[model samples]
Target: MWWSLREKRRRKMSSTHLHSQRPKRTMAQKSMKNPRSRSRFSVKTSENYIERMPPEVILKILSYLDAGSLFCFGFVNKRFQELANNNAMWYRFYAGQQAKKKNPRLIDEVTDGLSVVGIQERPEGYWRKQFFKELAGYNANWKKKLKAIHLYTGLPSQTAQILRSLRVRWAVTLTDGKGRESTSEQTHVHFTDAAVTVSWSAGDWPFIDQLTVLKLHGVVRVPLQCPDEYKPGWKSLLTKVKLNKDVWKLCGSDRLVKLLYTEQGITVGVWQEQREIAFIMVNLHYHQLVERSLLGSCVVQYQPAEHTAAFDDVDPEYGLHGYAAHIELHSTAGSIASGRFSQLFCTKDQISDGHLQLKVISKSNRSQHAPLCGSISLPWRTDALQGQIEGCCMLTLTVFDEAQIPFWCVSAPVAMTTSEQAEVSYDCTGESFFVRYEDAEGKVEIELRWMEDHKQYFMVSLIIFLSISKVNKHFGRDYLPQ
Candidate 1:
């Protein structure tokens, strides 16, 4: 009886110890019990499950997305960023983008069949860099500005005559930012005199002055277009409809802001007090132009007059005798400037057979800032004007800026006279005659020398000296006391 009572007491003590060692509830058990906690827990597990997926499956899913979407997906996680930057995939994306360009080139065709193995072997991030480079250009807004200058309505009589008789030729070139040039296949615009009128603007924007705003009446030839490889840095050369759209500006030396409309493409030049003294038109045939070459040397061309002497049977007074005008462009080095001069346009009242004479006077030299040198000889059409000197004889030389747009016009007449157009002054030597025109805009001095051979007039040498002035002013309105 005493042993049984001791065993009962031990059992009671053991029961009490077991009661004190009871377990607490676990987190998993709590989550299972609560509905909101269960949903939150499941979401975390699902994200981890996706992260643990094989790279091949993840990449396959990403391949279905567009370039922009795939690029954004990289922000999700480190693993996703690695998958998104795959060079082979980006290469394909880039090729697809190329195909969407207005004038898609053969580049897309060549890349179409590229094997995965070949694309994979490219440098790390190579295709990604290329794609972003192209995208930077593509995403920017391409724009140009158009305005009409009263071509005929209000002008000086002399200026009116010049504008009425004005003729232009369009030429285009491609530039690679570096000093490289590619001229157009079709050098001249089909219609040289077609002006960019409000009609060309197509009623998109209100004209500043409709009465002064001329309308392009006739059917106009479409502007020239370039392939993708030859695309210009600016979109102005490509589309006409976008003229009214807001422009995206570029930074740097090649920065082009406003494009003034004339006949063909836009004209880039300096404006003073809301007046355009001179401008060079970007040839309608091309959208963009680059500096053709660096300047090397300046040159001088001279031919001495011939003296009729010795025993000659032929009469001194005879046959058709007219003069040919010669131009010489010199460089800082006193050597002839190399590369092609911008353009030469001559207008005369009495001479016949007026034509374009372009001669590359010197071979290109490896130099920088050398003005492009060229020679032009304008001779009277031998078909007309046999013997007498008639009316006004004028030669216009238009000088271009780095953009190949005419900024200054040097108009040199055959005869030296004080006229309403320009103040005429001359410095005459036994060999040559120098006529100079200077104003706030710039300075232009042209040298002309007459050469005589027998009874016939041989050649007129013209040397043009040009200088541009940079003038800046603070903006404010001047007021007069009432």
Candidate 2:
């Protein structure tokens, strides 16, 4: 009996100890489930989750975020700020923002981030001081984001430094409009303080080309030894100045050939003497001529060559003079001589000097008595007629055939004498006849005559009279008879 009681007591005690240990284990697990009780584990879990994501994927997600979001994220920790400030990363971000919209806040954020990372090693206040100094030097408005800059007096070091730091590519313009008045003034300066050095990684400058650099100023300095792919946009600034063969040979044989002929469309052959220097003007189609690369090489060879002969005779006046005429006579008959009549008159000053004489040899086999009639018109103007030379008026002769068909004519109008006598004679067929004249008005008159004493039928002629006066000073000479 005593042994049984002892064994039961021992079993109960052992069971009670095991139950107490189970409660302790359950309480420990409940404490772990509560977050406040497991702060260290929660931190470890968060770190592992972040570490699982790739840095590039994180950056991509950050790129889609706005500047404000990035700024907020930057304050999350030092690691985030460093990621936000990476040059390649931010460069793309800033470029995208600038392309989409002109946001001052975005620029400010970018500049601020850049300034922070750029001068982190400097003194505490050194960056601020330098920032203001550069700001003043650039005359840049921090409040307003910059789109373009015009550096007239050469780019300053501070400005260049800021541009380089910002990875900003810019074009340059050099103008010579200041010294136009002074003849001895030098319009352009050979050297400028705004020298730039380009270090390219790609085979060629992709975003930058001849078209983009239309406004680049001064000569580009080529490195003594450079990569074969690296061309310096023509290092010499000898544009529009002719180059000698030796000088051109330095530009490469193929380049010289292209410069002389193919590029300019100028068929360059051997000349008597080499043209050391000549201004070359390129006549290209609109878009092609505007290209900076084409203009750079082409302007060196602009020489105003004399135009070659394209025609046999090119006169300044009476351009390409030739003549064609037709003659027909009708005298109570159908037609006399009508065929193609072409005549080219030589350039004669007499034709314009009120004295024109043209002889027509008939091609038609018709006899001369077949009522031959012809008319002649000059290519230029003739002199106007004046009246009464020493009480004798000048008259122009017109000849006609017996059938009253007019043949030859003169430029001068017939003028009759002032006498009322009806016996003034005009030699028609070498015969003298009487003609009558009357002065109806001052410097104006009329004349009449009868042919063959036929009283009922009268041969009438008219004239307008004029008198000569002292030459006006403005005219400076006597009147030329017309």
Alpha-carbon error at 204 in model 2, in Å? Answer: 8.0
RMSD in angstroms, all models? Answer: 22.3, 33.5
lDDT digits (tens) for residues 1-482 of candidate 1 = 99999999999999999888977668788788998987787675445676778999888998898766777677778888889889878898678657667454655574756677888888877787677546544222221111222232111123222222222112233233333433332211211121111101111222211112111111112111333342222211221212221221111011211223332223222222432212222322111110010011111112224322233233322211121222223211121221223333221221222211222121122131122222221111112121211221223334443223333333222232222343232422123334443434444343333333332221222223222112111111111111
Error of 2 at 71 (Å): 10
TM-score of each: 0.27, 0.18
lDDT of each: 0.34, 0.28
lDDT of model 2 at position 232:
26
Q: Output the number of the TM-score-best candidate.
A: 1
Candidate 2: tens digits of C-alpha lDDT, residues 101-201: 55544554444445545645544434323332332232334213222222321112243434333323212221223311110111211111222222111
